[model samples]
Target: MRLPLGLAAYRALSWRAAQPAQEPSAPRPEGALLWLHATSAERLAALADLGQRLCAQRQGVNLLLTVNAAVAPTEPAALHTASGRVGPVLALTSDHPGLIRDFLNHWRPDICLWTGGDLMPNLICMAAEQGTEMILADVNAASLPRRRGGWLSDVTGPCLMRFDAILTDTAETATHLRRLGLPGRRIAAMGRLSTGASPPPCPDTALNAATQLLAARPLWLAALLDHDEIAPVLAAHRDALRFQHRLLLVAVPADADDTANLIATARDNGLRSADWHGGDPIGEETQILICDDSGDLGLWYRMAPLTFIGGSLRPTARGNTPYEATALGSALLYGPHVADHAAAYARLAEAGAARCVRDTASLAAAVIQLSAPDHAAAMALAGWETVTESAALTDHLIEMIQDRLDQREAAAHARA
Candidate 1:
């Protein structure tokens, strides 16, 4: 029952590849290994949430999670423990691949879960060789061009095929993988792991304040706005102001300091603006509210009936998550370059739940059109429908993981 020599070699190479300059001398524990590479703070939060959920559902399961040092510098950070029995989440940095290797050697986990990008095929091969179940959750296939050339073409195909279970966000991705030679049985359409049913809960007081401030005002949230797109966004904001005098624009700047420039831009374009940096109460006459803080998009999305997702306007930035807004009952308005989440956005737009604006002018017009009471309500309804349709897929994924664990335990009992 030993794994093939090639597979064993692959694991050894992978472990060595991940080794840091200075090796740790301490002994590691044996448990479940979860390798996560979250590019955004939002994704990092999601991983933490998933870890908490898993630990709560399954007791006696030791979990070791790896994050990039840049993302989470501090090791051994406390994760929100599920039922308090699954042990504290031990966060390790991948800055020293050697440290990662040392930790893996010490903690021989039963299952290995890889999240985010940065696929290490050798790691997958190693996990398989060790008789550990390998699951790649929230996995995304590279865009077509990226797959065609260079080192990826050689390594990606074989590396991807080695996984015991590959869960992707969309059917389009599954088809793409099959085209790349991954067996259909091994690849399942798990929808997007980040697309959950609810937004992170916000304080009731803040929610009430936002609601009261938005009463009878045509509100539009332009989230994650980059610096280069500011001019066009301001132009669109002015256009919206012409029709709806009581227009409210909530801008979430891409950079924290960019908030000052955004407010200045709005004023330069003859639009009245205010800042919410100090947690001040929004005055009735405030035309725009600049939210400079982080991790409050969940609350803002819920406060608005219509939202224009930023980072799409200019060619520089691709896009941010529209699912969060849709899940919070807001109609989506996006620009081009949304290839990252193209499938989900396409589905929502086709269903009349979302609109993709080609430019600043189009964005302005769409906002005005969508702001009508009846039109806005219909879009919100369609949005909720599109988001809830994936509920079954979520449940299926949870069930699949649980069933696998149960089967593993049952087999162990039989052997004993």
Candidate 2:
């Protein structure tokens, strides 16, 4: 095949310098390997949920996850999360034509989910020639490669044309691609590629009972409360109630033993307390209701629009995922110690969906600020948008990927 002038130029420049050596990796896993790529760690965060879903849904499917010249990840072929294996993570090789071919030859992925707009000419061209199924997703105009040289005829259009399908995050992005000469049928406004797990299940009867019982009281939840963190949480809640006198704090302990400490802290703060397990009555004077040690947070999340995740105040902040709150229409508040879920919290913080508190004072202030209906509503809306921005479209796309993989595997077996 004749190389387009733009692609030819790209290949020449891409290989002008010595390509970095590919890192040593283990033998590829046997099965239908699905490879995914993003330009940076932040972009890679969007793929984590997808990778986890793929790995969980189809045990036979192997994932090869990569980031482009961004921070390299340890492990290969399957992305890993705390709970299970998503797939191996690696840094993509520099776009040198030879290395590109070498990398593809080694992996031999059945399909590629390429995050859209940051087109790699040599890599795309090589992959296309090798008959790899390429799908461009989360297309954004701002993410497209900017013109560095006028002399190089635009290669983005041609590189994108190689993709089997181009799904955009918005109609504007689809329209932008159309202006680049991609056909209408080839592009669809599929919204963003983002992920959030379903909110914890809360039955309607329980939700309505709690909502009516609260009777317009300012409410906040501190869930998965660490033993040491209980004191600080109660202190913050007590401080918050000074200004918002009708405030109610619902607490859920991380461990059953932690319940004793929580009740003691509430008493120390001179706040009236109700314990779910102890069968203490919840009356108008009751300010703290300790949820039954079940640690089921769905009911509390639905009861309160403001949530402060526990365990985030310690040095080893094993914080909860912020999506659980955002997915349940609650605004998030966490502490300085969120290394485990830094990307998720960062994403939410950037969008004004979450707030970070350094100490009890800040947590108290956040609670007070969120007490106002308008303020809480705005943050809740932002949380909903930030966490769920691309959830539906991404879910559909994931299903499509699975179906395609299944079809290919079935055909391959027949051929064998």
Q: Quick one: best TM-score, which candidate?
A: 2
Superposed on all Cα atoms, the candidates' RMSDs to the truth, in angstroms, are 8.5, 4.0
lDDT of 1 by residue, 163-251 (tens): 78888878888787777767889888776554344465778888887777667677888888888877788788889888987888888
Badly placed stretches (over 4 Å) of model 2 are: 12-19, 54-59, 73-85, 148-155, 202-218, 226-229, 253-260, 291-294, 311-319, 336-343, 346-352, 372-375, 406-416
RMSD of 2: 4.0
- Candidate 1 regions with alpha-carbon error over 4 angstroms: 1-29, 32-56, 59-198, 279-284, 403-407, 410-416
How high is the CA lDDT of each candidate model?
0.67, 0.79
Each candidate's TM vs. the true structure? 0.59, 0.81
- Model 1 is weakest, by summed lDDT over 10 consecutive residues, at 74-83
